[model samples]
Target: DQQVKQNSPSLSVQEGRISILNCDYTNSMFDYFLWYKKYPAEGPTFLISISSIKDKNEDGRFTVFLNKSAKHLSLHIVPSQPGDSAVYFCAARLKAAGNKLTFGGGTRVLVKP
Candidate 1:
C-alpha cells in the first residue's frame, strides 16, 4: 500500500524562478512531514520539514506547507538555482511508528540556467 504519492514524476524550472513540488498521503496517522534532496550517487539529505500542527514552515529559500484536511503537502523553492537540481522525496512519519518513515516516489527537479 503506497500511502504517500507524488503525482508528478518531474518538474522543470528556470533559474531564479520558484519550483513547487506536491505530495499527497492517505494516512491520517502521520504526525510529521519531511522533504529530502538527493544528488546522484548520494544519500538523500534532509532539506526541510513541517509538523502536523503547523500549516507552514520556512527556512531560507525553502518552505513546506501542510494541509491536514487534504492530507497534502508541498515544498516551494524560491529563486531556484542550477545547483538546486535534484531528486526530492516527500516522507511522512507516524510518531508511534518510532523512526519509521513512509516515502513517496521521488520527483526529479531540474533547474535550467
Candidate 2:
C-alpha cells in the first residue's frame, strides 16, 4: 500500500518567489520526514529533513514543517531560482524500519524566470 501521497502533481513559481510543496502520509509510525530534489536523468539528492520530535526545521532557503497531528508535512523554498526547477519527492522513514523509506509520488516544480 502506498502510505505517502503528494496531491499536487506539479507546481510553478516565479523566480524570487516562494514555492511550497505538500505531502501527506497514512502511516503514523513514520518518525522522520525528508525532501529530495531530482534533476532530469540525475539521482535525487537530499535537500532537507525533519525529525518527528520537531515541528519545523530550516536550512538556508529550504524549510520543512511537520504537523504530526495532521499526518502532513510541507517543504518551502524561498526566493526560488531557475536552478531550483526539478522534481521533489517526499519520503518518510519508520523508526523501526532502519533506513527503509516510503516515498510519495514526486511533485515537479518549475521556477520561471
Candidate 3:
C-alpha cells in the first residue's frame, strides 16, 4: 500500500500563475509533514513543513496546508516561476518514529514562461 501518494505525476503552470500540488497519507501516526523540492540529480531541498498540531505553514512563495483529520495535505505556490520547476515530494514522519520519513512518489512541476 502507498503510505503516501501524489496522484498527479506531473503538473504544468504558466509563470506567475498559481500551482497546486496534492498529497495523501494513509497512516494516522504521521504527525510531521514536509515538502521537498528536487532539481535533476540533486537531493531534495526542504521547502516547507507543517506539524500535525497546525493547519498551515508558509514561506515566501510557498505554502503548505495540512488536514490531519482527512489524512491529506497540499502545497501551493503563488506566482509560480521557472525557478519552481522541479519534482516536489511530500514526506511524513511520526514523532515517535525518530523522524524517519516516508516520501511520496513525487510530482514534477513545470513552469512555462
Best by TM-score: 1
lDDT of each: 0.97, 0.96, 0.95
lDDT of 1 by residue, 2-54 (tens): 99999999999999999999999999999999999999999999999999999
lDDT of 3 by residue, 48-105 (tens): 9999999999999999999988999999999899999999999999778777899999
Query: For model 2, how does the per-residue alpha-carbon lDDT over 4-53 read when each residue is reduced to its tens digit?
Result: 99999999999999999999999888989999999999999999999999
Worst 10 residues of 3 by lDDT: 92-101
TM-score of each: 0.98, 0.97, 0.97
Name the lDDT of candidate 1: 0.97
Residue pairs with backbone atoms closer than 3 Å in model 1 (clashes): none
- What TM-score should be assigned to candidate 1? 0.98
Pairs with steric clashes in candidate 3: none
What ranges in model 1 sit over 4 Å off?
none
**Candidate 3: lDDT of 55?**
96
Can you rank all candidates by lDDT, best first?
A: 1, 2, 3
